[model samples]
Target chain A: MNRILRLFAVTLIAVVLVEVGYAIPSFSRKYKTSCSTCHYAAPMLNGFGKAFKNNGYRYPAGTDPEMTKEEPVSLGSEGYKKVWPEAIWPSDIPGTSPLSIWGIGRINYAAMNDVKWEFEFPHEVEILYAGTIGENFSFFGELEFENEDNQNEIMYPFALQYDWSPGLHIRAGMVHADPTPNHLKLTRNHYNIASFRSRNRWRFRDEQIGLEVWGAGNGSGERGGYTYRAGVVNGQGINDMNKEKDIYGKVTYKIGGLGETGGTAGAESQTSEFFIDNSVTVGGFFYKGTASRAGFNDEDFTIFGGDVDYWYDRFIVNGALMFMNSGMPGIPERKSMVYYLQGNHVIYPWLIGLIRYEWEDADTDQDAVKPVNAFIPGVTVMARANVKLVLEFKMFLDDVNKKNDTFTLQMNFGL
Target chain B: MNRIKIVVSISLLFLLSQPLFAGDIKGKVKAKGVKHSGDAVVYIEKIDGKTFDVPKDHAKMDQKNLTFIPHVLPVLAGTTVDYLNSDEVLHNVFSPETCVDKFNLGTWPKGQIRSYTFKKSGCIPVMLCNVHPEMEAYVIVLETPYHGVTAKDGTYEIKDVLPGKYELKIWHEKLKGASVVVEVPEHGEVVVNFDIKR
Candidate 1:
């Protein structure tokens, strides 16, 4: 590879290294409950957590008033809703501070073929805020600080959401535009397809500034139900100079489990595994965007994917497949694909064991580039309700002789 | 002489069957470490040689406005209690206690009643509903009918206690109080106060 290309890859990898999963503990404070109430662990939501998200961060059964331990402060009066034209609509803000702080400390080991390997530590920090606004509105925001090249860089992503119904809602601002799960990934590195970037730098994990409409509902008694979301985003990510906008849509259906309702758990997360229900969720999504450049002709790319998640007893298995089609004006059009299969077992409520296999077939016709195959086996331990410890060993199947294996240990705490 | 002897025997039997010298046990209870001292149960332990008949009437606990109307209800052992749902929404009643064999009354609509009988004396069971977990109440089953719940001011009175030396106990869901031996005086009210702690 050329020096410039190698440098770009290294920079991107460094950026991804600091991208850790975020678990908001502010809700726990507001509810006066433990983090286990909504998370299998922080960031990896269980059935109830999914339902809670679908309801715009409110209780799904419309029992917020009864379940909320801490009452919210009202911004406007309910008496004003009847006089809309003459008065502002009523809503409530969190009674307590809605902010949560997360610190990530890590030790990384790489068996490098060229460069000296050293352990990395205390890589990133983030300030996160998520809470409900009144009855039908909610918001989530995060400010991320990372250490790279001996410098601290900051990035902020946030969104405001409004719930129209259980089957429909609207969200605006910087948001995750893909149908597949990325923001909530348990692994240090995002799924291959979600992190895949084209030559023009269009990565799915980049929080796109956009507007999305989504909805979900629990049918009945763990029968699960449906979830659908679609969005129109600035295809080039934040602060795009081009007029072209990207659009994507996704739909999912889950059966025989607490898809999103989590009625028994009552919109609460993993509070415990005793309530884990058997479920199968299937989904499909597509993203079409144009990558613009000043000197060269614009390139258009489209990615279509299908994903599935299965939960049975203490085991959860999930997989995704994505096919990408790209047209770069001076070169011949190319097609590529990335896919991964993963499984997780609840060895204990505090301990999780997982294995993932990923393969990337780039430029089908390019014989010079061999398919990249890898295996990532990891274990996550809950040091406490608010602390998590993860250890992952990743091995590249195609580069075993090149001594390119990597292992990472990360400690994340939120308060 | 034979007729007079029979009449006297019958009269003695009738007098023995009645509570000739009964008194009222009334007092103030100070439940420490809590907001309100109300709902604490004060009752007399079972008599050594006596057992009251199970009341034919049923005790009623009403669910209204997402709350249990009577937070604490004491009933004689083997008494049937009616769980009534008066809320607009459906309500369910279940207990995790083994006293009532973990009785579960499934969801019911407004104005419906589900009943369960507590047959074990000295069994205290918490009633809960899956529909509204916050709604909680306690059922205190006792062998004696002499029981009273303290008012908000912490005053309680168990009337018509037969003259005897008996154990008087206080039961609070979140607090514990020491039991005392009380000697009842015939035909009068006894003022016994108690202090409960966490």
Candidate 2:
């Protein structure tokens, strides 16, 4: 009890200090739009937001609105310094460089026998750079500082995208792999299944070095459109030790709602106009890879999943299901299934109520870990368009339960 | 002899009234694949060997509720437009089109107005706000004053056009536009319909 109280006091003070000291903005700065324009809440993408990301961070019209041209700075006859050498050297290509910063601070308490509590002043801090190199080429890069293994670690994701047309793009570099579309959700807490799978020893959805080709059917509407992505990545994570590469793919289609009906037929570019009513999207994904474990030898992991997101008026519903099959050199094959369902409704313009249920069966065999189920209920408060506060409670259901239920309070703000 | 005289008098009266009356172009625009076709501009293309004087009155576009009140505004070439900010927060108006010289009217507070003159005819400039990226509007400059904006039902009427052959054009922000040629009679109205699709 004393340890828990001491930890709580320290966390509270740290939260107060960070909340008053720092304010950093995100992609809202590059697009010069409000956070709500693409987010149902900060970090959580709506239909339009997904389309924007799939479009290589450019407007659906195939233009980079943030682009600005700058003259080179001369250093007296020696040479000139240009932001983008390609923009001035071989040929003149208009480009813009927009830099932004993002940071999050968290405090958590877990209800256990000892009542554990802890505070992380800043769970993560990231510096983001995104823009266009010319008319058809664009890029996004992130440098991050994170708390890992009780120490600070530096990480980054870099990718370059080439836009062949409004409906076609090829992106190459180290980037986040998408096993489920909710990778961009707004809340600091994650879906139970996503956390469970990501933390597994195999590391299925972690960022990896890869090349992806993606395209969208409609210009930028929230409905009646489709998007597809396929990529090859080093399955061993950022720094690879394996020689074989993994293949992954995802396809999503918007079934019905207000659709995009603009843009010229067969044209490479489009106008920057989109309409949004209620929308829904359904998608499926697959990943196949091989990893070598120290004791287990070489193991093959195959994963397949499906997801859906729907928005109607003030209500939003999302869910995902995944099945995994694993095989080791001399061990019996293991199969498992994980799934989560979530629903959110806007009780007020600034307040949203949410509920989610998740289940995970670690293995199908008799020796498999007892099936785990969780129920989570939360509320999100929007102090402003760029700021949000979340309170979540997690309850566990299991026969041989380890006391792991938790209560979390988080604050996310952008300038 | 009396019937011949009566016919001659009627013919002369008709000829005398022809120049006194001007023709009107009225039509309904059916916009396919868009949120109700409101704010689409229907105007006359430039007439050869003819130039129009800039209107003395300035056109107004208001920024209210974080949106441009009239999403689309059409004006004669060389006419001036006034941008009014009605929101409490600061707002900026600018254009990237070279036809308008890529003008950037810096940020201003509530109730403030900024003015810009568009001298280039046949130029359609998209208006944007740096402070609010989602806020967008269009300024369409035409060579003549004969134009009307469509309502929610896609109905529009361009009144008092001189009787002649002219090309009618449609300017929509989302969909591609098509032009049609029509001959206006000396008097009465011409009812023409257009169906525009993406």
Candidate 3:
């Protein structure tokens, strides 16, 4: 009896040792990432975050030091580009301490007196990274300006994430909804809703708000391919508040198929603020209006839309058709439909060309005649990783006709 | 004669039934040739026997104040790891290598913990915050049970070794130190040293 008991104990001990031995290295390699990176709290992986990991952590270029331009041999606390065989100077700044800066200035058509010149001072000013304060928290914000104050804004992507399982997660806070079809169209897209609409649309506002929660089917914690997001948000976009209380919900689906051999499909339902990854999306929304003030209606409105997008490595095509109808007392029943087709081609990593055609019509003849057909051809140049310079030529026909066929050069940046 | 026989039998029984216990082993670690402090991870891997009380959690690699602290983490297989962020910004963490499980925690802010359980046993090279491109950490997952880290002065000691043969491993971020096989005799002290590349 004693011998058998001792043998059993020994066997148990052996099993545990083997299990621990096997588990140790596996545990170490499995958690290579910090918890906060994926979770709104910890140990969680959101849609975009998962896509990023699954995509092998490959992101847009010029954003990572390991992938950035090589450093030059120099002698200084702060690196200075020395005029040598390469005819280049060390562009990396000094005393910046965790703050890395990249800037671009274009003095094009200089000889022409109305010189189309633009300066982007530290245009792509992403802080690289500030610091992490604990196992579950950290904070960083980015400020950007373009054309020396023509446009300026700061983006704070504060988030908290926690993992429920290897294939499950929960998160909360303000973070960019996984890039939407509208977002993926890139600025190179000519028919983007933002570029064509004269007034802020209800649906576009839904896609961008302060709070969201998204998940996926695989929950493998990868960053690319098919994924989905559904969330509740402040119906009104940032910096806009009305007397009427509102809650917004959106559902988005994305996938990478044959067309996106080296790219992805992205779309969003404007009516509900839903952003889709890279796929066809169908959406619907309803919102209550605030009391009439300054000729605005107190009656609510309902909006719905279907959008589809296709993307190749460098080429993209998309079309979105939407209907917005308002049912307010006293005002005539108002209904409208807007649709646009856009195409984009990557001329180079830093350069892209776009062409778009859009048409908008309202039941009211007055709304339909406002120069609905527009031809916009534009080019976007990557002045830096997060900074871009665009030159767009706009030609309007019929209705709201004006000689705004002007030359506009602008620079934009984001962190 | 009978007394001597009994003592010999008891000693034999103790040797066979229970492993020997030795002095405490401890150490700190330092980066060999860099002004920047390297993140070092220390762990022990029991070679052949399974010890249930010992944990299998992966050592951690954290980003605080724009730097990866304790950059090196050592662990045995099947351990849980806790990744903490001590910063004032959001970060996305992920690794694409096949040897390790990949995950991206998007936009994590202050006071958050992401945990992962490693099921495979091997070393994995990790990168950080797809959004914040500068942070990095590594997981040195080993199969053996004899692992430990060196002190800031690059010294280490391991104790409580049962009589057995173990391959001692010492690792430093950016440096691959030498590994040696040593036997821990019953209740005896053994000295092992290593020199790493700068």
Computed on C-alphas against the true complex, the DockQ of each candidate is: 0.09, 0.06, 0.02
> Which parts of model 2 have CA positions greater than 4 angstroms off?
A1-27, A63-97, A113-115, A181-183, A198-200, A219-223, A258-277, B1-198
- Let me know the DockQ for model 1: 0.09
For every model shown, what is its TM-score relative to the native structure? 0.76, 0.60, 0.42
* lDDT string, candidate 2, B1-198, tens digits: 999999999999988865576798888989999979788889996888988778899999998655787898999988999988765434568898999998887655457788899988889999997545678999999999889999989999988788899999888888866799988878899987788888
Ranking by TM-score: 1, 2, 3
Candidate 1 C-alpha lDDT tens digits along B1-198? 999999999999999876889999999999888998899999985998899999899999998655787999999999999988765434578888987898787655457687899999989999987544456999999999999999989999998899988899999999999999898889898888999998
RMSD of each: 7.6, 16.2, 21.9
Tens digit of per-residue lDDT, candidate 1, span A162-211: 88877788999865575556434777767988777765767776667789
lDDT by residue (B1-198, candidate 3, tens digit) is 999999999999988765555434444454557663334444444455555433744567676644566666666666677777654333446776667656554434446666676657656657555533446777676665455555566666655666666666665667766655766666757766555666
The DockQ score of candidate 2 comes to 0.06
Specify the highest-DockQ model's number. Answer: 1
Worst 10 residues of 2 chain A by lDDT: A15-24
How would you order the candidates by DockQ, starting with the best?
1, 2, 3
Misplaced by over 4 Å in model 1 are: A1-22, A113-122, A148-150, A182-184, A218-222, A259-275, A292-298, A400-402, B1-163, B169-177, B184-189, B196-198
